[model samples]
Target chain A: MRTLLASLLILIVIPATIALGIVVLDDRNYYFISLLIILYTMIPFAMVFESRKPQARELIIIAVLTAIAVAGRSAFFMLPQFKPVLAIVIIAGVSMGAEAGFLVGAMAGFVSNFFFGQGPWTPWQMFSFGIIGFLAGILFKKGWLKRSKALLCVFGGLSAILIYGGLMNLSSVTLFASTFNKEALLAAYASGIWFDLVHAAATVIFLFLLSRPMLEKLDRIKTKYGLIER
Target chain B: MGRDSFSTYHPAVNFLYFAAVLGFSMFFMHPVLQGIALFSAAVYSVTLSGGKAVKFNVIYMLPALFILAAVNPLFNHAGMTILFYLKNGNPVTLESIVYGIAAAAMLVTVMIWFSCYNKVMTSDKFIHLFGKIVPALSLIFSMVLRFVPRFRHQIQAVSLAQRSIGRDVTQGNVVHRARHGLRILSIMATWAMENAIETADSMKARGYGLPGRTSFAIYRFDRRDRTVLVLMIVLIAIVLAGAGMGENTMRYFPSMRMKEQTLFSGVVYAAYSLLCMLPVIIQLVEELRWKYIVSRT
Candidate 1:
């Protein structure tokens, strides 16, 4: 009940805070709203962990998965937008539960950006990747998403890239530009489609090659060490 | 790696300086202010990186600036003053062209500041600042940061081993090369998983995440750090307050209007310049001091 209430509070607080944030923060200081949204997302993530009391072993696996998701970017440097980061993140989510997935996905964006550069986009990256991971985990847990290779690839190929790239395009319009013109937003999204498609194709490739093996390995680790359960 | 003066300060001091300068550069869209911010950041990047700065400016920064400036006038056609008509008969406005240039400057300045950040704030320093407030998080962050480099090194070794067996990425056709690369990656993944388990075991052995398990830190809020901190707060407050008052604000919509230079805005600009230059100045002073002491001998 407490976990449910905390999740409820988290959901309620996000939109409320954002509405309040629009009123409070100026356009110039709008990244502060992004930060607020990031904080809002973290409330649920932290609460889930707090309630579970995750052991040191579980934390380490999550950290390692996040590390792979981060380091996964460098592996695909030769191939533009052929990132295994999202694929690795989704695999982690599918094998582990939602909370671990969120942590790994959020940390992947967070850690990688420290290498790239932090901007207003950082929090958005974190939130999008985190949510994608969270949803994958939840779906896997509820048996809505099968553990089959084809199913995972299909789900990941369709969702993670579009959501992540699409959301980032929306943020580019909101954060960088002065006016929030729908026409401008649409143009931005349209321009971003090629990159988004490239990312989606990459997601499909990585998921095809690595999803089953990675998931099996993660499942083994969870059972062997009594780590995170899906 | 340890060449920069900002590295010597407390993590809090280093982080605060970058945050303030970056925020100021991004939000303050005044043309003159953008130039100042860009120039100051360029100077600092050169100081930190020396001759390599020229190469970076040419290879990365210049192209980015040009692309950004050129791209804006293409789409955004909002202003009283139309600059030119595109081949499609769409009006390209003077305001967008100007806004494009300013945005480019802002982007370049922020990028330069980040390069400076990369120089000064090492992963350890980043972890150090937040380790206390969020122990688990900092641990994971530091670990992940560590893994980026480690994974790179590991891939090198794996590739070398693969090359010896004629399974090298370079030795094959496009399809064969990709297969070899994935083989290496698959190995790396397994290694990463095992390595993480070993790491967890080590931490468990060390009684990490235990109640009252204290940590030793090399960073402290020293006297110099205190002064830097105070300066950071004061300068940021003045700049933010000035921005809030619309002192340095530049509007580019129906028309372009530069903010009139009030006394308060002047002070804010001076404070900002000093704030941005503080790292460069500290580095300069240290260099001069070293030379003087050597000359005395």
Candidate 2:
């Protein structure tokens, strides 16, 4: 009940803060405001997760998964945009739970940036990857998404394209242009389509090969350690 | 890393200083203000990281600036002064060209500032600042930071072991190599999971998650930190007052207009310059003091 109330409060407060930011702040400040909104959205999840008083084992498992997702990026340096991060994140969501999924995804995004370099795109990347993990968990929990390989691939590909690619391109447009216009948005999307396609293809391919073993490993870990049970 | 006096302050002080400068750089689009921001950011970045920063600014940021500035007028045609028309019947306006340059400068300036931020605000400092608010998440963050390097080393060892068994990533076609890599990753995951039990047990033995836990940190809010904090707040307040009075922003869409230069505006500009150059100034003063003490000794 407290978690639900917190979620309700977040749902109301975040949009109101964004709307206030857009109304009160200057147009040139859109990038900062949007980044703030992304930061704000992640806070409630963290708050809810913390309030639950999670055990040390639960935190360790999430940390290990997030570290794998980040370290896994280096293994695919030969293939640009072909990373196992989303695959690991999706597997984390499917096997662990939504909150763990969000934590893993967000921390992976942030830690990876520490190795690469933190830029204006850091918050957007974190938000995009986190939301995908979150939605994957929710849909799986609701029985809308299956544990099958084919279905997971489809979902991963679509989410990679629509969620991660879309948000990143929108951020690019926001960062580059002073004023937001339809032409700029269209141009940004047009130029970014090929990159997004490659990324989606990578997600689909990673999920195809990784989902089964990864899920099995996570399940074993849960059974062995008596982790956070659904 | 090049040592700067600013980085020696409290993490809150460092965070506040960067937040103020970055926010000001992003919001204020006046040409003079933008120039001040860009110049100070570059100098401070150089001071923080030395010649490599210069190479980064010239190699990556310069071309990015030109490309962004060139691309903007193509899509954005929102000014009264029509410079020309493109093949797509869009008017290339002077306003858009200028706006593009301004936005690109702002982006580059912010990027440099973040580089400086990444240097000064180490992970421990960030964890310390945010640990209380989000204890579990902060713990996870610190754990991940430690785990990434350990995992990377383990990955290397696993790949080598796999190579000895003739299932190497480098000794195959693309598909085979990818499969080998995935196999190594799978092994790594299994190892990580199995070993993590020990980590959790160790934590449990150490009384983790207990109430009244205290973290050890080297930082303190000393007199120097307080003085610097007060100065930063004063400068930030003056600049924000200028912003409230519309003296820190310029109109650049559909027309070009600027707040008239006045005595108060000059004061605001001075305050902003000081705010942005705070780190560089502090570094310079420290260096001079060190020189004098060395000569006396």
Candidate 3:
């Protein structure tokens, strides 16, 4: 009972407290709240591996990877040059499991929105990015991350964009088109397609640019960190 | 024993405070009331935490301007004074602009009020307030709020570690980059699964979900709480009565006639706004008293 309480406190309570504090103190921005959630979720995972004494080198590597992923994800919004989000989601998924991937992708959306401010769209972003990661994990577990399976990478990129863009369009129609008119719903969906297309294209470009080097690096990490057994 | 002490508030008072703030933010619409609410929120925030109010404004107020500018004009076309016309033939009216400003102001004000309330209302108070009605949900909400930040930090750590292995996912083509991103997701999933298994095992061993789980809290309802609760109820009642009367008789819409604003209406609107700021005021006074007492001691 005590252990359960402790776990609950560490996993849920402490993080919630910090998030609430941020929400209260930081203008109630959903990005800060989302960031808080991701950090909190990681606590238990970190604790589980604490006995392993994650070397300073490993910690530094993790920090850099997170910054790169977040920076890449945010850069897509500014420049039409790359598929930053797709790269982050695929790499996260292939290297982490579905849950971690989901958390990272979702957090990317959530954290990025701090620049934009919180809105009804935050939860949808979380769900969309989360599923992207989850899907990547399933594919990776099936040896899809291998160099010979480069097509799998393209498929994953296209899939993430399609799923995220499609769901967002649906949400825009359902949530915003509450005028209860079919015409209004159709119009909303139609208008939304352009934005979704832009997002989808961005995802494809991001993945195409970053996949190969990221895969080789992840394989190396798996070996060094003993992430893969034998 | 002191009236200004944090421990003096009852759980019921905290609950009422939460309900009133949430409800008012969602539904109230009088212009005077809204203006007062905006002012009171600003005042309360500044007084409660000194210069922290400026930080709050940057984080909350700046974005509200963009939302007001972008969203309000697009949907609402209701106004008498036509400002201009779009090339597409939609009339840009003065009234819509005003209304949009009002809506944005209201949204920002409500958010600020909630932020202030979050600071004043501690987690222990919330846990105590809702423990009886729905302990499980309260516990869950508390936990979720606590963990969100930690989760963000962990993702950062993991991402950095993955990047160091020469998997710089940030520098590549769209398709190749996306595939690399998938790797990160796969690693995170494996870690989550492992964590979930460990958590479930721990929970099972500790006999969670067992019947009759009792929680121990560090607060108790006292005389100060009783007085505060009575005052809040009375204030809320007045605000509601004003709202009901205004709904029946007052013209909230645009009107040509320039009739003098009635004293009763003004008082009622002021009261409503003041009620929204009551929690902040209480906390401020309490903090001041504590400081004074501590200096003397």
Poorly placed runs, candidate 3 (over 4 Å): A1-230, B1-15, B58-75, B80-94, B117-188, B247-267, B287-297
Predictions' DockQ, in order: 0.44, 0.78, 0.05
lDDT tens readout by residue for model 3, A73-102: 544556542446555676767666664566
lDDT of 1 at B283: 87
TM-score of chain B of 2: 0.93
Q: Pick the candidate with the highest DockQ.
A: 2
Best by TM-score: 2
- List model 3 lDDT by residue over B1-297, tens digit each: 233233246656766875675456534544666677777777766665667776877775868656654555555454567778878777767766665565566567766666556555665676677656544334433433333344455556777887787454674687756666666655653453344335444655776556676667777777887888887788788877865554312222242122256776666666676676776677678777778888653
Badly placed stretches (over 4 Å) of model 1 are A1-53, A114-121, A174-179, A228-230, B83-90, B148-191
Candidate 1 residue B24 C-alpha distance from true site, Å: 1.7
lDDT (C-alpha, whole model) for all candidates = 0.79, 0.87, 0.57
Q: For model 1, how does the per-residue alpha-carbon lDDT over A97-176 read when each residue is reduced to its tens digit?
A: 77778888889988888867765577788888888888899998899988888888888877755788878887776555
To one decimal, what is the Cα RMSD in angstroms of model 2 from the true structure? 2.2
Residue B204 CA displacement from its true place in model 2, Å: 1.5
Residue A228's C-alpha lDDT in candidate 2? 57
